[model samples]
Target: MIGSGPALAADGASTETAPAEDVTIVVTGEKQDRTLQQTPSSVAVATGRTIVDQNLISVYDVLDRMANVVVNGNRTSFSIRGIDASNVLGGGDGALASVYLDGAVLPKAALVTGPLDLTDIAQVEVFRGPQSTVQGRNALAGAVIIRTADPSYDWSGRARLLLADKTGERRASAAIGGPIVDGQIAFRLAGEIARSDGLVRNVNAGGDADRRKSETLRGKLLFTPAAVPGLRVVATYMHDRHRRGGLYVELQPPYAPEDRVSTSDLIDVTEVKSDIATLDIGYDLGSGLTLKAVGNYSHIRSHYAYDPDHSADPGQIAVIDDPNKTYQQELRLNVDWNWLQGLIGAYYLRDDNRGYFFGATQNLSLRRLGVDQSLLKLGLPQATVDTVINLYGSGVPIVNSLDQPRVTQNHAAFADFTVPITTRLRLRAGLRYDRESQRRGIDQRVAIDKPLPDPAAYPGLGPIIGQINGLLQATAAAATSYQPERTVRYHAWLPKIGLSYDVMRDMTLSLTARRGYRAGGSGLNQQRGQVFVFNPEFTWNYELALRSAWFDRRLTFNANLYRIDWKDQQVSVQLTPGSAFDKQVINAGRSRLYGLEAEFSARPTATISLGWGAGYSRTKFTDFDVGIGQVLQSAAGNEFPNAPRWTLFGSVTWQHPSGLFANINARYRSAFYQSALVQTHRDIRPLTLANAKLGWQGEHLGAFLIVSNIFNVEKPVTSALDPDGRLRGMVSEPRVMGLSFEGRF
Candidate 1:
């Protein structure tokens, strides 16, 4: 199991994940599944203690602050080693990142964004590189495994309250947990609430409440019957809701004045609710082995909304509503011998996502709006703007809404076995057979509102209708059937065999080769892009790793070299051609990626510990020729979109024998592009920031303070498409601070 301590003891519970439990030599990032000093893979683990100490609530906070993971929007669209995409519409399809809360997967991508309320968390494991052989999803890049502590039969609980003021914002949060029953049941509940005043001010729409207010609640329950000593059942539920104002983008050109972007009037409300219940039955076979089984069920639902430009324009209105639901059932059986262990399992995943979109544009004529310069500027307006909008209708309440349905049912059986031919040599192999039924379609209907009749005399003109009209109808249907279904059976027998050799007492080296995959889906929302289709792809990775400790166990090191061959890499691109159509997800031709990753831990004194993480990646599309080239070097290759080339995440922490505590943490990320196909933004660069904590922990009480962005770096977070094309970025987090107190009864 993953745990915690001083130097090596950091297992599953401890959040510090730093040096482990006081020189315990912790290790969970590798192929052999041993301590950091014993495992031959470069992994990063964060403990619950570290999370609380650092005041991290959501996955975004932890990834951006504690680990070296980078994401777009400063907090979302996660990416490890340049494997992430921009989430322009809030709903991004390139979410290759897999989230495993405990052992069950987080179905929807939005839930992975923010406000996780890091409470009762055991450990967070960040696996680097492809790991299709041992994980649930055949992740394209890697996976993040979050393991929470099990409910203890013993009664134990902790609670905390926090208050903070930064710049012009204030935040508050509180939580509590304890035992539900003597020795058979236990529970934990945690919640957080925070509100802030935004940094940007829109004089056009003034409001100090332009900031966001968020709330979250999480509960954990565990039961172990005395009559059934080995059987334990656990359940978890989480709900998070956030409403933000002033979160608007700008729009320029013929539609509005220069630098005129939407602001505060644009209201955004998003919510997430997740329910999970699991039962584990373990039995002792009475031999050198035991039997363990895990049965899990989880459900998550979320809704996101935003008003692009909050005004009475009647035009320029945009609304989107999405409700995603998922049901997953998985079972696993594990056997452990003296020198060998393995697990066999099967999973059933059902997901359905339904959404509605409404977008309206300026009421002005396309020629006047300058939508197509060739059509209007130089004399082509009729063929350009006039024709498109004329087909859809005009003026207020334009019927430009679409219904999108994405549903999938997939079933697969997979198993991975680890056998030790000797104490130092082992073999790992896995296979999976997947069958999926997928359906996705975009059904659109443009409302045609006939010219309003003369109301003066129309008092007799029957409801906005007039004239030659015994021939006119109240409603006209401009709709079509958009139904598409495809059944697929994916067969992949990913066989992985690695070699491990122990050089010294706590030193090891291993090499592994495995294959990863990306699921196939509908082509695109634009029916025009079906010219030449592409197939779902696969990526094969080869890795060599080393793990060791030296200098009287005071220093630890982990390093790996890997190269990936991505065939049929899927990429998303906008089809605007000469105009701006935003951007979307699509499968690219092919690609290649190679990199070096490493992590280190050192303790020169008894009270001070130092930790470091670094990575270098080169991901490119080797084969993509649609007009770009059969050998396309997209903006993605010139620069990895949303993924930094080099990142460093580390901490210098000091502990006093009298219980005083202090630590400084920082992250540095190299610059990368925001899109895969555009040279539109080449001036973009990377960013570096730091956070510090000062506190005291007593046997019964604790007090602490946190300061974020100590350097107050004016970080320029580049965007794929700013509301105004001239402004390349938006205002980023300037600085933040908070104070908190905790007590144990």
Candidate 2:
């Protein structure tokens, strides 16, 4: 198990088969099935029973309780150890980490907008280090694998209803499975619907600013032809829709943490819809050999609209629409033998993303371009300079329309093997050759929204007016529509080697080294109206791990220590200071990161369980120089944004013989910078959150009371200075109490 914690049975009931220490956990993240203790990879596993017991409503909720993992406040990105998912190389076309549902890889936009609600799930596994050899591209940092429940021979069903206070949260979910043919076919179906008024109160709009709603449905079919005893087939389909309000709120005077209020006149909204389908087939050939094939397809669409100014006036609104589609196929053969065990696979993928944007918003970068200083240098009158400054200092509004489309195709062949060198020692090695090609195109248009001032109104100002008008027109022209298409190809060889030794009957030690990679891509410089390409980045990771069992198999302890060296990092560079539109991705940064993670779980008694996890990471740029404002600066010693140095979590659970149970859990994160700029004011403070559940469980029915954020700790998950010189950001959700009822039959 990921936490090695006390896990309930699949039916949400206490395990009576054996002691906690004797429980066996099978992990499949590595494209093979192995007991947790036998797997040398650094991974965490959470079962469906754990999700229900802890009230983990989504994947993000589960990530919060894991050590050395952080999800950004916006939910658009996450980080494993000190490596960010999206911003590791500043900004890029590919993510460092990938999320998978069933056997389907989720699209990038789906990571931000789609519903990741946890319903009828079988398991969730998080691989903490580089998975390049087995996962190929976009596995520079890690991967998240989720498996939903499948049909079984016996009929089974489960249902749950939930309600919460203040936020007006409500949820209903159900899952059922049964055998269609006594021994050949089976089917499963699951669905969920959820709604919440959200915590951020839109005071100006007279409603909740971050209201949310989601719907999810899934179905699975399993077939085992009686004639083909060794053959098995599984097909799955899922649909999800999610809608939510804005994630940010204005931070002004008289700010009340408990109130969670926002003053924006328009409540920003986003909606995402997704459809996914997967088919998996396996045939067991005799003699410990198996052949497997998988195919997946997914489509996701997202729409977003927001008030860019964060003010009460009807100023400017920004809107975006993104539609993405993906298809993947994989074929692998597994071998299990006394001397060696391994798998060889070939994979292919195609992804298409189409995005469109239309908006009218203020352009702060243009306002900061030293126009007034240039005018003064030209010997313009002080009064005239002041007038021009007043006219444009607040920023000039501009209308922008953009259409960006990207298509990518990947092909790879890989193999992984484990060999027994001795009775107590094992060697593992893996290699992959990957080739990827991407085609991206952009079409954008920009125009000033405010008309030029008339020179007739002021005497003796015609020359200055003409000069200002000319400058404004030049700026607009520089930002005008630019249509460009580019195709880039990247190829890489990824390899991994590791060794594991059984030091004792109940103890194991392992060491691993792996190379991680991300494919290179092209980006557009809107300000320069040009296209730029960046090189691929790589990382070498060294990890040491220990796994142990103690106290007659009642206690478990695991730890991992790792160091990562990164080179040719694709960092975002602003060619012109104070101009956001002049930025492009470049391979101009290097960094180093080291971290330690430890977790322990103990079942002191049959009814009592305890688990604790802690992580510490030190991250710094080793070689980095970039433009900041009007000057070049070095970030060699600065820590990565959102990478907290310390993170801790703990949980305790008690189940009484009288059908009553209780669970309490808490998580803490140390203060850390929220921006790569590393300013003192941009530091987000430390935060601690706790949750509790009290419930009664019977054979077929259960009820519980859940209290989240029990102490109402309201802290900013993200923070930045607004254009108006005010501190504005998104705050964590406040305390919420809820009741839930569940039934199993």
RMSD of each: 6.6, 2.7
- lDDT of candidate 2 over 1-745, digit per residue (tens): 4332444333222222123444556678899888666777778777665687688898888888888988888787788997887766466778899899988888777777685898888778889989999998798889999888888777888899999998899999999888999879989999999999887877787778888999999999989999999998989999999999987776556775555777777899989999999999999998989999999999888888887766665566788888888999999999999998999999999998855455556544333555666677788887878776665545766777778788899999999999999999999999999999998888877788877667666577767777777877787787675666678899999999999999999899999999999988887777666777888989999999998889876887888999999898888877755555677887777889999888877778878888788889988888865444323245677788889999899988787778798889999988888766544653788899999989998878999999999998888788666555566788888888999998887
Clashes of each: 55, 2
- TM match of model 2 to true structure: 0.95
RMSD of model 2, in Å? Answer: 2.7
Report the C-alpha lDDT of model 1 over 177-267, residue by residue, as the tens digit.
Answer: 4567787877766566666665544544454424666776667777777887666666766666655554333333432322324443434
Could you tell me every candidate's TM-score relative to the true structure?
Answer: 0.82, 0.95
RMSD of 1: 6.6
